[model samples]
Target: MHDVIGLVLAAGAGRRLRPYTDELPKALIPVDGDTTILDIALANLAASDLREVAVVVGYKSNAVEERREALERRHGVRLTLVHNDKAEVWNNAYSLWTAREVMSEGALLVNGDTVHPVSVEQTLLQYRQQEGSEDIVLALDTAKVLAEEEMKVVTDERGHMRRITKLMDPSEASGEYIGATLIEGAAVPALAEALQATFERDPQLYYEDGYQELVNRGGTVGTAPIAAGTSWVEVDDHRDLERARTIACRY
Candidate 1:
């Protein structure tokens, strides 16, 4: 595999996170005793040899950018920061659009507010093995107990995505879509076209909508089912932050 670029989408306002997000962006929210959510994310990626990172920032972009720079200086890995001016109006699909040029090809995409166990590297490696055959490789937490608010995924026996449903009924859902994906360079143009169409229709559509569109268009979107042993969390609310803190402190 060629040198892979990494895109970290950190632009959402994270309204569900509430008072915790009242001051800083979700990416900068302290998950552990001192480590911010973004810090742990970058550290995990760096550990996986997934370098050349670019972070898309919004909602207190200055603080996120400053912290990103400081973390890069300390970690010895350069981080590129991209601004998402439409963060308030658009969803993470726009955040990914902002980093179109940041990654050339063979890139990995992840959400900044999420933290997963070291197993994420292996998930990426799984995609590397498939390469150009798949348009997108999405990570799924197969063991998560589905709640009403979380996005859910349904897949065929072969792990191909059947359909992505949001706010799905927990009783009927199969697994959760962790906000991480790998898209090859060949798929970028088609993905871009779908995103543009989505924006034209509704600029505020969620990133999952775009991925679902790819599935609708016969694009090959595969799933990597992370076993129950792997740790993954998205620090969107105070409770989630505390949960992540507990895990991070232990890790």
Candidate 2:
């Protein structure tokens, strides 16, 4: 197995979250009592046996810096903060590109704002160990009822991703591409180039667009379906935060 690192993209300003994100980045917002979104992300990575974790911080990054020690102790993992200088002005495609160095060593990437159980990480890693696994494996919520806002994916019969975007019709999607990915070290260079192209094309584009870019360039991206009844929430707004709180405690 590759020496994979844990990567979390926590740089988004999450403007829609308003008051909660006014001072803190979306990742710092609390879900469970005293346990913030970043806390859950770290906990899940640690539970998956990832000893080294890199968090890309930008908006209100000092908040994460201040809690670095405490979070490391709580999660039993070493923390590395990768700063995204343009976090406030750019989108997550740039945020993800900022972690290219770490990604070069292989990484299990997770969205900081997402609250999920360790099973998601475990599933990705498990899929990586299987024969015929693709270079990049994305966690897909095949059972979720996708909406326009959710990042959607279309796949071939062999489970290779054909397309990924938020603009596709929901009924045409195979599932929602939850904010988790297993990236092999070998794919980093191509992925970095793809990401750079994606952001340069449109700074507002999401990192999922980079995945599409990679696919367009003939890169093979595969999927791992999250187990049925698995609970997860991408805390983008107050309503999502409330849903996160409801399920976070269960994990």
Candidate 3:
């Protein structure tokens, strides 16, 4: 994974989580015992051999910075904290676009709120290596039931993504994108362009919308499904946090 730097989007305030997010960014919220979501993400990236990790921080950026040294010592990965000043109003499209420099080296972009085992990262890496695939390879939960809130995906028969958005009907979705992806160096420019277009169109657009724009530009984005019976959750609220707590221990 030398060529692949780990890029984590950890800037969101997670308003839906309310008091829990009042003092910390969503990435710092503890999911498994005292191990925070960012901790899990960094640990997973380290396990996957992604030793160079860039964390885009916002909300209470200082809080994450305070923990940076300890995280690096524990996980053995170089950490670059990219501060996002517009994190309060703009969405993750802008959050991701701000990391254009780091991502230019190619990246394994993971949403910091997601709590999953190293298997998720492993699956994405193995698929990219074994298949010799190019461009982005998003981790899809083909077995999971989709909901309107989920970032859904629709793919062609050959597994290339056709559409990726929450607006799509669950019936039309091929799978739910679990927020882990392998983005190649060659595709970084298109991804950056797509992210720019997405934020320009609407500041509230998600980074996933950027992926859709990439597809519109005829960029290839593939999918890799996690192995069966592996549990993972993206913690966005109190209930999801509880679910993460339960599942995280298994990991």
Best by TM-score: 2
Q: Which pairs of residues collide in candidate 1?
A: none
Clashes of each: 0, 0, 0
Ranking by lDDT: 2, 3, 1
Cα-based lDDT at residue 3, candidate 2:
83
Best by lDDT: 2
How close is each model in CA RMSD to the real structure? 1.9, 0.7, 1.2
Q: How close is candidate 2 to the true structure, as a TM-score?
A: 0.99
TM-score of each: 0.92, 0.99, 0.97
Angstrom error at residue 216, model 1: 1.0
| lDDT (Cα atoms) of all candidates against the true structure | 0.77, 0.93, 0.90
Q: Model 3 reaches what TM-score against the true structure?
A: 0.97
* Residue range 22-81, candidate 2, lDDT tens digits: 999999998889899999999999999997999999999999999999999998999999
Q: Which stretches of candidate 3 lie over 4 Å from their true place?
A: none
lDDT of 1 at 28: 76
- Give per-residue lDDT, candidate 2, residue 181: 98
- Candidate order (TM-score): 2, 3, 1
User: What 10-residue stretch in candidate 1 is worst by lDDT?
Assistant: 124-133
